[model samples]
Target: MIRRANPADEATIRDCAEQAYRRYVPIIGRKPAPMVVDFAAQIKAGHVHVAVDGDTFQGFIVFFPKGDHMLLENVAVLPSAAGRGIGRSLIGFCEEQARRGGFTAVRLYTNEKMVENLTLYPRLGYAEVARRTEHGFSRVYFEKIIGGPGA
Candidate 1:
C-alpha cells in the first residue's frame, strides 16, 4: 500500500533512497539529488509518500504542488524491491493526487545519466519537455497532463 509518510518513517525512507541510488553515485560521479533530501522536513510539510508491504518499506515518492501543476521530486525503490512495479505505482499515485487536487499536469526531472528513467517516463505517457544543466547535473524534464485533453 502507498500512503503519506510519517516523521517516524524518515529513516526507512532515507535508507531506501540510499540503497536505490547508491549504484548511480559512481555512474554519475556523485550522489544523486534524492540522496540528500531532508526527509523529516518533507514529511512534516506533508510531501512524502511511502510504499509499504506490511511493515516493510518498498519505496517512496515525494511531490508538491507548483502553481497549477505538481512537481514529482523523487521516486526511489529499495534495491531488493526493484522490478515489482513499485516505481510505476508511486508515479500513478502522484498522478492521482494531482488529478484529485485539480492540478493540470505533473512535472518531473531526472538526471541525464539515468537512462532507465529516460525510457520509462515516455512509456508511462510523460513527454520530454526540455533538457538542461542544473545544479551541476544534466537534467531532463518531463510532464504529463492529467484529467485533460490528451491526458
Candidate 2:
C-alpha cells in the first residue's frame, strides 16, 4: 500500500533514499540531489508518500504540482526490495495523482550519470524535454503527457 508519509516516517524514508542512491555518488563525483533533501520539511508540507508492505517500508515517491504538470521529485526503493515492482507502483501512484488533480502531465529529472533512468523513463512513456546543469548536477528532464492518443 502507498500512503502519505508523515514526520514519523522521515527517518526510514531517508534511509531508503540513501541506500538506493548511494551507488550513484561515485558516478557523479558527489552525492545525488535526493541525498540532501530535508525529508521532515517535505513531509510536513505534504509532499512525500511511502510504499509499504504490511508493516515494512518498501519505497517512497515525492511529487508536487508544477503549473499544468506534476513534478516527480524523487523515488527510491530499498535495495532488498528491488525487482518486486515497488518502484513502479510508486510511480503509478504519482501518475494517478496527476490524473486526479487534473494535471496534464508528469515530469521528472534524474542525473545524467543515472543511466538506468535515462533508458527507463522512455520505456515508461516519458520523452526527453531538456538537459542542463543545475546546482552543479547535470540533469536529464523528461515528461509524460497524461492523456491523448496512445496515452
Compared with the true structure, all predictions reach lDDT values of: 0.93, 0.93
* Steric clashes per prediction: 0, 0
Model 1's C-alpha root-mean-square deviation from the true structure amounts to 1.8
Query: Highest TM-score among the candidates is held by which one?
Result: 2
Cα-based lDDT at residue 145, candidate 2: 88
Candidate 2 per-residue C-alpha lDDT over 1-151 given as tens digits, one digit per residue, 9 for 90 to 100:
9999988899999999999999998899999999999999999989999999898999999999988789999999999999999988999899988888888799999999999999999998899999999999999999998962234
Query: Model 1 misses residue 6 by how many Å?
Result: 0.7
Clashing pairs in 2: none
Q: Residue 33 of candidate 2: its Cα lDDT?
A: 92
